[model samples]
Target: MRAASEILAVWHAFDDFPMETLTKAWHYRSGNEPKQRSVELMRLHRERYGSSGNCFDLALWLIDAFRREGISAYAVGHDLLTPNAHVAVAALDGRGRAYLCDLGDQWIEPILIDAGSGDFTEEPLAGFVSGARVALSVRDSWLHVVYLRPNGKRSEQTYDLRPIAPDALLAAGEYSQRLLRKPLVERRIYTETEVLHWELGDDASYLSGKRGRTEEEPMRSLADRVERIHRHTGMDRQVIEQALTVYGTASIQFD
Candidate 1:
């Protein structure tokens, strides 16, 4: 297994990276290029315009980072039957111990899961600790995750531990970005430190911090909306501009 320190370092590096869900409509309208490799995705993130993608893109990027550091890492995802099929990174340390490293979910650090470990709950990530519990369990050969909210609420997801080849992972991401009906994408939901929801032809709603304090701002011009989103998300201004442009022209509607 790799050193825990190394895993923690990688987690810190990307802990605050923005996570965005762009609809296929936005993707096609922006004329954005298709994703094929982790390196390509990283380059897009580093560009003057920032990059935003689904969980697959985020997980692949983290897996790539671990590989670059000589740690054994792979992309893991659940099958379609799961409630919210998701992707994350499974990294093996030098000692062959595996840990779950999830950046797309904004985890504070890597979670340790011993082989055949049964269900359990752990404290929230460092910066996000609010007496909430992150529970992990194995069921139906898939990793089940539940984020227990402080208010007795729970958000759930699952990931298949079977390692997905890089090529296959890329294909899956492309397919999701192209053909999948992603409600988050449809609603133009994006979150980093806060949750942002914006729908075409409607006012934008922003939930600042974990307290869920929400504020609604009237939709000004598309340019104004882009600026507002960039300000709150700290995403690349250019990327937000392009995405908003696509949002406007695509005439995307919510279900």
Candidate 2:
């Protein structure tokens, strides 16, 4: 339990780090290596742009951090064929208990996946998500998660706990970086009572929590949107402008 708690503590530190593609969109530099970016590059991006890449990038960052802290962590994922596939870290504690650490989808914190852990319980865990309760069950080698959200809506995902080969992971990361969708971002902001998701996307932006959701005021112009994104995300003005400009051009091309 102590080991899992330590992993959880590391996961909590990233609540403020956004999982977005803007930084990579603008600061891209092609190379021979696979798309798993170095933590140093991510640091430079955060310092200069205040934004980061998608799930693959975030997973890489977290795994590297765990290793530096002397923790045994590895990358895992599912939906390997989809561009929208997910990636996350499976960190093992001193006793080899594995905890699922997901920051890309921006989970509130890490959760214990090993049912064999000392403190593992059957009760659904709340607070890890807003407006929902998370239930974990392990079948064979996979950890299955079910989110019971409002209106009886049930969402499910399974993590293939088997460790991914570094080369394969990097190849997938490279493939993921090639694709960019709408100019968007999602971040988690937690309060004493609930977790709030701040989302900015193609059509509308809003803040959603357990109680309700509030729409963000629309930006008046391109420059206005850049300023607002910077204010809300603390990304550098220059970086935001450059990245958004690429998306704007892509929109024009597609249109």
Candidate 3:
């Protein structure tokens, strides 16, 4: 069992707070790599406070920390086809046999959760003095969770969890170091949201235009924009740009 301090440390490392620091870290640039907004947030945190790990860094550290705490954790790669990002440790027994003890897995840690998948499950990760029912969903084969906050506002979180041998991680790590060259495909980031998968990259597709929107107002807004563009548009290019300016670049093309 991890001590209170260690658990708190893990929480502190992962909590998405102090937007300024997080902004820099999220946007930090390395060499010729493109700017990542999250890196900016992280860099700000590192500069002002000292050390703060991004989701990937946090997972790696968590695996190491769990190992220190006597858990035989191993890292695993996610899906081969999808974005399939993130990593976590596998549970190993005394005889070195590994089962699906993905408790420490970062992408789908909730699966390791002790409670049943029902109405009254206690979720310590809910971050509330009192836990709430965190709903789960899938998109592009990725899993996600939705829940209400203390203020009654709702939000969602995404992640992946994988099961593999310790040797698999060592091999994957070595392969990346030796062979793979693409940064986006190479460096694993712990963005495990099912929604994000449908919204990222060239193949991104929306189940509907309303995949991300939860209410009618936004949906109507989308409808209104599309109607206006259809009724009186100089060209699709201009309409698309107008949509981009209002709803974002993805909104224009995601159908």
In the range 114-174, model 1's lDDT, one tens digit per residue, is: 4453423343442332224576666655776677664668687777888888777777766
lDDT of 3 by residue, 1-255 (tens): 112333344333433221111211222222223322233443554556433332233334446655666756555436422223335344443434332222222222222221132322333233221123355554443445565544455766554444445455444432322221111100112243331111111111122111332222222344454333222222233333342343343222211
Question: What lDDT is reached at residue 225 by model 2?
Answer: 76
Q: After superposition, how far is residue 93 of candidate 2 from its true place, in Å?
A: 1.5
lDDT of 2: 0.76
In candidate 2, stretches whose alpha carbon ends up further than 4 angstroms from where it belongs are 1-3, 29-36, 251-255
lDDT values of the candidates? 0.58, 0.76, 0.33
Per-residue lDDT of candidate 2, residues 121-160 (tens digit): 6578777765677988887888788988766778988888
TM-score of each: 0.73, 0.87, 0.33
Model with the higher TM-score, candidate 2 or 3: 2
